[model samples]
Target: MDSIDLEVLHACDQWLRAGWRCEYVTVVRTWGSSPRPEGATMAIRADGVVVGSVSGGCIEDDLIAAVRENGIVRTAPEVITYGISADEAHRFGLPCGGTIQLVVEPLGAHSRMDELLALAQRRVLTRRTLDLTTGAVELAQGQADEQLRMDGQALVTIHGPRLRMLIIGAGQLSQFLAQIAVGLEYQVTVCDPREEYRASWSLPGVEVVHAMPDDLVLEMKLDSRSAVIALTHDPKLDDLALMEALKTDAFYVGAIGSRANNARRRERLREFDLTEDQIAKLHGPIGLYIGSKTPYEIAVSILAELTAVKNGVALPAQMSVEHGKALAA
Candidate 1:
């Protein structure tokens, strides 16, 4: 399913097109294990209708009620917080007594949402800085270093680009990986030079590139939020592009092969002048050790490991392989 923020952003764009006054309410910060992350958002209408959510259903319902009852619906742009105490948590469905801050800004023709949409479309890393004092918004170049100022007032927020992935092959495994990646909001691109594989490839919502893998990686300028996975297992095709991707800041670069083949791939990369650390980042035997036998099962394993590394989590040596199959059996 599309994320709440993405859905709200889509609704906001539609509202703008229809010329209705709308406000974008974003969850800027959370004190504890909140329902959503820092960039969570909801779009509210003048009539108190809301789409998307910053918390569980209760908090969204309260926000909707606030629009209908509170006078701020007609007054100005502002920020609000909820679930600060045990009572408030009970009322808002926050499991652990926590709080979440939201930034509610009335939408306008000059809200810079077009830029945000454009950045999201291209999967470019864009950072938006909101000046609470002046209520001004600034779009930065990228998302590496961001500063938020919540000091005393309501909230200061930043929205970073969604992580992206580029799979160098359009095989069955790539199809499975692409589908899962899209659900996770990764803009997926599949590259394949082999006509045999590219011709039979068919998957919705994934970009199919017929260019040479190395050229595609270079042209795309794989950035830090990007990931490159080689699924073809063909050295001539996969290794050429891997050499180029390793030089870039792509967060995760991996290939599918056996443990012995992984060793060989490392030796080849080292010969290409990739430093020890750079070559070490390449995750081969790509998936966690789930004993995956089928292409789909293997894809799940690879994506699980990818997610772990992406979130800066240390995954166990054994992969999560029991997703399918009869657990009772």
Candidate 2:
């Protein structure tokens, strides 16, 4: 789930707790060139205050206007469509005659938003099923592969972390990377056996553990939705973890090092039981070639490559740090 949508849910929870009526809006479907994707959410307070966004801006303005004019009168969830006509598209600032279908539900105690927020905070994947007829909701454990679905009867939405990241160090670079990963909605865990490093690291919303990298790797049981990044240059720390992670279904397994160092690391991994194809999956010289000289910039470069891989974008060879640096040399 997006952090923005989570914030929207949090705001709705607060409003309901304070006895303020609010409407929860979700973008169920989109046609043509819409600004927000399906499953994007927004919350509108009774006084027209809003959090999160379903469109660029104009659609939000219209929704707020309606709420302020008549108040939230609906006792049941309603499906509303915006930008049906070209004129309406232009008025709503939807580009290229885009259309957005939304489920606008009047939120109250029955909304279960507080419970949903708690589950999300706990990093539990949850499915929220809303009965369109009765405004009732049911929550269940959600699968990582599940997507948002809506029928004539109900709306099913998945929430919580859909991706997981394991960073094998508590160094400064690891700290920056972990923080950015959290904002990107990844369930981030940092493992560092070195007590000195772990003692100095205190970032919130990220799980820090005092365990060896390889042990943690096996314990995580990394799946296709998981990523492992080794920032600790120590072979004893990073190499074994990379070895175990490469054997798994992890989507991205990488280590941060120079070209020569990574070559040596690969040679060292050959001493392990990892197959050639599995070792080949390692992304050493980990990030894109962004000329990153600082910790934050390096973190950005690494995440850029990770995002590209996640989206199945095939970047050119020259974009890699090794390739680009070689060309520069």
Q: How accurate is candidate 1 locally (lDDT)?
A: 0.77
lDDT against true structure, model 2: 0.93
Question: What are the lDDT figures for the candidates, one per model?
Answer: 0.77, 0.93
Tens digit per residue, CA lDDT, model 2, 251-309: 99999999999999999999999899999999989999988999999999999999999
Each candidate's TM vs. the true structure?
0.85, 0.83
Off by over 4 Å in 1: 1-7, 68-74, 119-124, 147-149, 153-156, 315-329
Clashing pairs in 1: none
Model 2 alpha-carbon miss at residue 73, Å: 1.1
Cα RMSD of all models vs. native, in order, equals: 4.3, 3.1
lDDT for each residue of candidate 1 in 186-269, tens digit (9 for 90 to 100): 888999988888898767778898899999999988887899999988998899899999999998999987666877988888
Number of the predicted model whose TM-score against the real structure is largest = 1
